[model samples]
Target: MIDTEILGWRAALVGELDHRRLKAPSVKLRSAQGAADGEAIYCVDLRVRHPNADHYLTSTELHSVEHFLLEGFMRLLPAHFVSVGIMGCQTGFYLAFRNEGRAGRLCDTLEQILAAIEHAREVPYANIEQCGNYRNHSLADAQRVAREILARRADWLDAA
Candidate 1:
């Protein structure tokens, strides 16, 4: 990482972060000040940006995926994981895990999650009684993305 400050806040130019050259999905861990206990927190990002691809996930895919990942991780890592969310730009997911050791397990955990996504019959909580806009879930698109991720998993797994 190259620190290149611009206007005010600190920043760094992360090398090989380009979507085109990426092999597998990976997250970078960084410690920072600001938490409930005033201790450093570890942050990780599971980016899904594709190179030269301007298109993003459709609304249905996004809606379904959110519920799937949230529940999936809650089932997978239990207490060690914090949260799973989609990136605002629609490029990928954001996962916040506890510490460095979790980073090592990130790829494997995601592989399992993707496998579940591939085999799932429907989005977990897509019901009028369960969710606000529950009709917008799309299992097809979610599975498509899961296949894509699985294809690239080897590339990323090695890096992670």
Candidate 2:
């Protein structure tokens, strides 16, 4: 079952984002669809499927990583864009921007997100108790999700 520890992680992420300066002037979460919804936006998907696994990162972890990545993106790629958030079937976290013009900017951001995941793998997540589903997962499990997602993303790049 999905855990509450995951939610604590979400709160931490939100807190982190609140403290940072995002590159995009406008970023937000929504349930709508279309270009107007994502135009000039920097979309982030906390819920990414692994090519060969049924398991996925808990929503809390995804949201936490989104916050971590958002800080990195603002620092690394400050291109103008919008932000959109959504709840995914497996998990939910996003920052969608408008148009395909920001693809290059997004690639750079994605790279940093992957790097952060790798770096956090060995680092302890003392924030577990504060996450939405603390009892459901562990640092080890988060690391596994990171490894699996990173590998899948790499494969995606190679295939593209």
Whole-model lDDT values for every prediction = 0.62, 0.42
TM-score, cand. 1 vs. native: 0.72
Report the CA-based lDDT of candidate 1 relative to the real structure: 0.62
Model 1: runs farther than 4 Å from truth?
1-25, 30-40, 157-160
The parts of candidate 2 lying over 4 Å away from their true place are 1-39, 42-47, 50-56, 84-86, 98-104, 121-142, 157-160
Residue-pair clashes, model 2 = 30
Model 2 worst lDDT run, 10 consecutive residues: 23-32
**Cα displacement (Å) at residue 82, model 2:** 3.8
RMSD (Cα, Å) of model 2: 13.9
Q: Residue-pair clashes per candidate, as listed?
A: 1, 30
Residue 15, candidate 1: C-alpha displacement in angstroms:
10
Pairs of residues clashing in candidate 1: 24-156
Q: Pick the candidate with the highest TM-score.
A: 1
- How large is the C-alpha RMSD of every model relative to the true structure? 6.6, 13.9
Model 2 residue 28 lDDT?
22
> How much lDDT does candidate 2 score?
0.42
